[model samples]
Target: MTKFNKIVPDDFNVPMYVNGEFFILRPLSPVYSNLDYDAVIASKEILGDIFSDNWPEGINSREDNLRYILEDYQDFQDRIGFSYIILDDEESICIGCVYIFPSLYEGSDVAIYYWFNVKFAGTYLTVKIENFIRSWVVEFWGIKKPAYPGRDIPWSEWLTRPRKKFTD
Candidate 1:
């Protein structure tokens, strides 16, 4: 039998660099009021089907966004799950988000989900970021085989099928 260890949120060091760019992996907080809401709304059009059920609605105002951020922050603090705001090297821009939480799948303990601005969708940076995330979770956090539940689409089709070479 294999020994199972739980991942504690404090084990992670925030604002780590990956792929030659500085990026932060801290949980969402109210202090992130500087988020570019307009850009997030704009990306929805480009996100297409991926944005369907995963994205939150009713973020028409900063207050709404803050509320969601606060909730996510609390979740991280409680070690229930983590929702990180992916920031730029200067930590001045919010380019995207990465969520790590308990798996909804029947036999998995953890799962991951991520998204970036449309501008990064087809770039090598996206692939690097994704690979960095997987390696980080396994090596640093000890989640050897994290799950990616296909809530938005079928897992086999989304991950294994021949698709656009966005992330290699």
Candidate 2:
């Protein structure tokens, strides 16, 4: 049996730059309400697909967005999950989000999900950020092999192997 423990930190530092000029990952909070909401609304189509079943209908509204942000903060505080806002360094714009949570997959203990603005899709920085998160999660959280549930390929086939150029 696998032993479960809280792997995420209580107070997360922000503006962690994984790909220097491309983007940075910062902890999400109520202070980011307007920016985050705008990003979500701008990327609604993409996020809808990623969060297919659970996508909120009222995500376009500031009130609903604030509630979601607050809930995310609470979840992070409660050690239930962690969420981060993705910001474009060049423009200082909120572009996307990353979420890590207890796995809902049958055999996995942890799961990771991320999304970026379509404009940033297929960029080298995307691959770098993905690799960085994978390594960071393993090293900082002590998770031997985190899983990307619902992905087209098995985690063992790609995640455990060396990083490669991301293909469509």
Model 2, span 1-168: residue lDDT tens: 332344455564423334544677777888778888777777777666665355756775999999988988876767767888777785367777788876544445577877776666567877777677777777766766576743544544534544323223
The global Cα lDDT (0 to 1) of model 1 is 0.63
Model 1: per-residue Cα lDDT over 61-106, one tens digit each: 7777777778777767667667877777777777677777765444
Choose the strongest candidate by lDDT. 2
Mark the 10 consecutive residues where model 2 has the least summed lDDT: 159-168
Backbone clash tally for model 2? 0
User: Candidate 1, TM-score vs. the true structure?
Assistant: 0.72
Q: What is the TM-score of each candidate against the true structure?
A: 0.72, 0.72
